[model samples]
Target: MALRVTFVLPVFPRAPVGGFRVVYEHANRLTALGCQVTVVHERWREGWSRPLRHLREAARDHRHRRAPHRAIDWLPVDPRVRLLIVPALTPAHLPSGDVVVATHWKTATLLPYLTPAHGSPVHLVQGYETWNVPDPAPVHQALRLPFPKITVSTHLTRVLSDLGVHSGQITTVPNGLDRTTYRPPPTGAPRAGVAFLLSDSAAKDSRTALAALHQVRAHHPALLARAFGVAPRPRDLPPWIHYAQGLTGEDLAAQVYRPSAVFLCSSTTEGWGFPAAEAMACGTAVVSTRNGGVEDFCHHNQNALLVEVGNPTAMANAIRRLLDDEPLRTRLSTAGLATTATMDWQQSTAALLTALKAIS
Candidate 1:
């Protein structure tokens, strides 16, 4: 009989973020590997969204939050895959399988109960979401579920151990990207300006990126910066950098990645560093700090321009290097694409499958 796998992320079936995207990739890819897979999640936040501002829209229409048409049910899933979408109030209902993978901290806590085996549930940790955030209801509350103990990074694995989880119980398995779908933007596209992405997600430390932007524009007065995700308020930073809120898929590719000179990451911490990987794959030289998994995918001189964490001056200098040295940027961009080939979704997916099998 084919091995059965259940990948549970209680928060999913929602919008596309790093974790959501990773879960979907695994769902499809695991099926290709001949494992029967079931994905259980709640696609929308619904009535539970504590943020009043966000609630009105999710309540007005399920489609009001993000790409409303981009619901999980409508996607073409693999024949061997089953997807379950539940509302917020409903408890995750399931039993043990050959393998149970939990993507979030809360989901991991629930995994032991979701399935029969409490001792060996896989925790797909991403970063210091625990260290940086205030209310770690999902992660800490889930850690109570007996972390299946697998992580997405060494830092995360260590974090779990520090939190009283057994070191041997947590395995590090980083997230991988599909370099094939992510292609370099054509050189022919008219360059509108330099592009930067921002999300308030605490781990993103977008404020650090903003701080660097202040120094960048000051030194190079002609430099123009454009952005995405929720625009920072007046208190966030200076007015020189442009912000466009959020973008995704092809629109993100054309509008944000195409004409951008270099991709920037000023994160204070990370688990897998999703934006850094995507930027490199799109052939944009990345100027980022050596935060988290950037070390795994980026080679300081070879693939990216990495700065010391928390140093805006170094960050600005790195960006200035990309702006001034075309050859260097091209070299980093070209090398970055080559680096991504080795660390594609295939690599991380293979490790995840192996970990599942090991526990099984």
Candidate 2:
């Protein structure tokens, strides 16, 4: 019998995000493997307590449910995979399946309420998730649930252990690189510019990235920098740093990843660093903070330069070093490419299936 897997997301993403992208990738691959896959987007959660805000969001979700295809036009989802936008995470809105997976801490809280018909419940821990909520007590509580946990990094496994999840109950399934979309160009060109992802989230630490760029610009006055994200460019952003909003797939590779000399990651934390891996796959050297997300594939002065998180001066120094030494940059880029080449969606998805089977 084919496995029936259903994923519950906290909400439909209004824009492209790493967490959502990972789910979509797994859904596509699993469908190819003959698994029955369905992704449920909880339109209205308890977090939006205000009546006006709740009504507004519910109305938007109704529009998406009416035309589900347009809701995720930004992502490449398999048409065979079912997409559902529900009013809430109630059992009444969910379909029974072989196994139901929770993609967020909030979604995990609802798993216990689901009957056996909803299938075995499992929590997919992409990050520590303490940063996502104002009060982390609930996040910790969610981690402590008896449900089996699937995490993306060693750091996250350790975190779950601290929260009292048994080591045997936790599985690590790292995110994979899409080689077809992110790879080196036919020929290398002069790529003097630096690139990084921009986000409104404070945890992404875009301020630290900007500060590091400022320090680099002090030495190389005409240094070129590019940042891309779903958010519009902030008004205070310096004109020298070009911002490209919502670039993905081939366009992202051609515009931001391929032409960059170095990719910068200033995030304080992550379950997995998707952008860094994609950039490395494109043969661009990387200078990133010691964020847990990148530790899986990045090495200090090997595949990429790793610095302490939240330090603009140290990140700036590493970026400067990569900029000054062409040979070292090429060496790191070559090594980075080799490192990411082994991380493929096929391997990660197989691991995920194994984890789900164990819980099921």
Candidate 3:
């Protein structure tokens, strides 16, 4: 019999999100491999305990459940993949399968309540996602749940182990790059801009990256700085910084990553640093902070330059070095492309499947 797999997500995203993207990737691939795969989205998960918010969300969830197609139009989900939108993640809302995977700490809370027919429960730890809650203790406690855990990086594996999740229970399956869409621009294409992602989240440290760009501008007044995000361009961003709002897939590759000579990853922390990996796959040199997410694929001075977290001056200098030294930039870009080439989706999905099957 084909393995039956079910993935429970916190909510359906209206915009692009890295953690959610990973889950979709696996869902599509697992379905292709002949598994009976179903992805469940809770239409009414408020993630907190406010009565007013609950009432507001309850109304919004009703609207979403009726028009879920509008929310997922931006993503390219495989036709064979089964999508289920439920009011909540309780066992009563879930379908029985050989394995049920929790894609977030909040969703993991449902695993303990599920019976065997819902499949052996598994947790997919994409990040140390403590920022969402006021108390990180619950997040840590979820890691200790007696279920197999799949983490995106070795750093996350160590995090789980430190929290008493046995080493034997954690599997490290790095996120993969789709080379067909995220490859180097056609030979002789313009690779002359520096790029970074804009975000409202403090952990992403967009202020540090923006400050570094300003410093780089002091030396190279005509430097082209490009930024993109799902959110509208901030009014305060300098008029010179070209912002592309909400670009994805081929358009994101052709317009943002391919034109850039360098990509900046200034996040203080990440589970897998998706944009940096995508930029590298586009053969763009990278100057990143020592964010744990990039550690699995980035090597300082080998594939990319790494600096400390929250230091604008150091980030500025590193960007200057790449802009001034053409050969060094070329070397790093070449190396980055080579490094990211190994992160194949087939391999990552296979590893995830193996872990799920073992637990099942």
Candidate 4:
């Protein structure tokens, strides 16, 4: 019989963000293997009066797709694959399946309280969403008991270990890139000097980067700054910064690193520093704060220039270094490309499949 799996993510089918993309890729890959997946996630609620045209555009492409008659957008899910709409705040019940993976802390707790209980529940930890939840003790205790942990970074692996999870019980699953899409554009336009890793999130620290860039632009008059995946309304942003929201696949890969001389990520933490790796692959030097697992992939003053987190002066200085020094930028960029070779989604899926098989 085909393997049956259920993924409990807080939001699915609605949000078109990086996390959603990761989940989708893994789901599609697994489905190709005669496995079935049920995704339990939150519905998207659009507050603005944007284009229903785009919603219709998306729905037309997918057969099981449902467009919001009121204010929701649902994916055209496969019959074999199920999409369960669950409340954002409530804990979910794990349906019987060969595997049940709860993506965040809220859903992770559900595994411990299963109707008949479960085998080892797969808990995928990205960042401190585990730490930020109401009370982590239940999840922590479960991790020590029946939960086999799957993390995306050495940093997260270490953090979970600190929380009493056995090192052996946990395996590191790094993120990957689609090289064909994100590779450098053939025209090779003059590098877009100003770039951001993402500033809006708690880790990204948008205010600090914005203030520092305001200072940097005065010196480099022609400098143009672009925020990736931060501001939804691109036009509403201050005229100084350029806005490119929701660019993924090959286009996101190409624009973020390929032509940009320097890519910036101000986040003090990450499960894996995906933007840094992607940028490096595109031959773009990275200027990131000394936060999270960036060091795992980046060497300061070597392949990537690392600044102290929240230090606008240091961030501006690092960007200046890349700006004035082309050889250093080339060196970092080339090194970044070399780093991307080792990490691929195949590694993550293989490990995940192993864990899923064990669950049954």
Relative to the true structure, candidate 1 reaches a TM of 0.80
- Better model by lDDT: candidate 1 vs candidate 3: 3
If the candidates were sorted by their TM-score against the true structure, best first, what order would they fall in? 2, 3, 4, 1
3 versus 4: better lDDT goes to: 3
lDDT for position 33 in model 4: 70
For candidate 2, report its TM-score. Answer: 0.96
Specify the highest-lDDT model's number: 2
Comparison by lDDT, 2 against 3, better one: 2
RMSD vs true structure, all candidates: 4.2, 1.7, 2.1, 5.3
Task: Give TM-scores for every candidate, taking all chains together and pairing residue i with residue i.
Answer: 0.80, 0.96, 0.95, 0.82
| Per-residue lDDT over 1-360 for candidate 4, one digit per residue giving the tens place of the 0 to 100 score | 877777777644333455555665577667777788766665433323656854653443243324221122222234455666543423343456666777766667667665433334677776655434468676566555557778777877888888877787787776666665556555456786777755456766877887778778878988887667735754556776766676655666665566678888887676677677777777778998877777778888778999888999888988988998888887887777787767676676766777678755
Residue 239 alpha-carbon offset, candidate 1, angstroms: 7.7
**Which residue runs does candidate 3 get wrong by more than 4 Å?**
45-70
**lDDT per residue, candidate 3, 99-181, as tens digits?**
99999999998899999999999999999887757899889888889989999999899888889888988888888879888
Please give the CA lDDT of all the candidate structures. 0.69, 0.90, 0.89, 0.68
Ranking by lDDT: 2, 3, 1, 4
Tell me which of candidates 2 and 4 scores higher on TM-score.
2
Error of 2 at 102 (Å): 0.4
Clashes of 3: 0
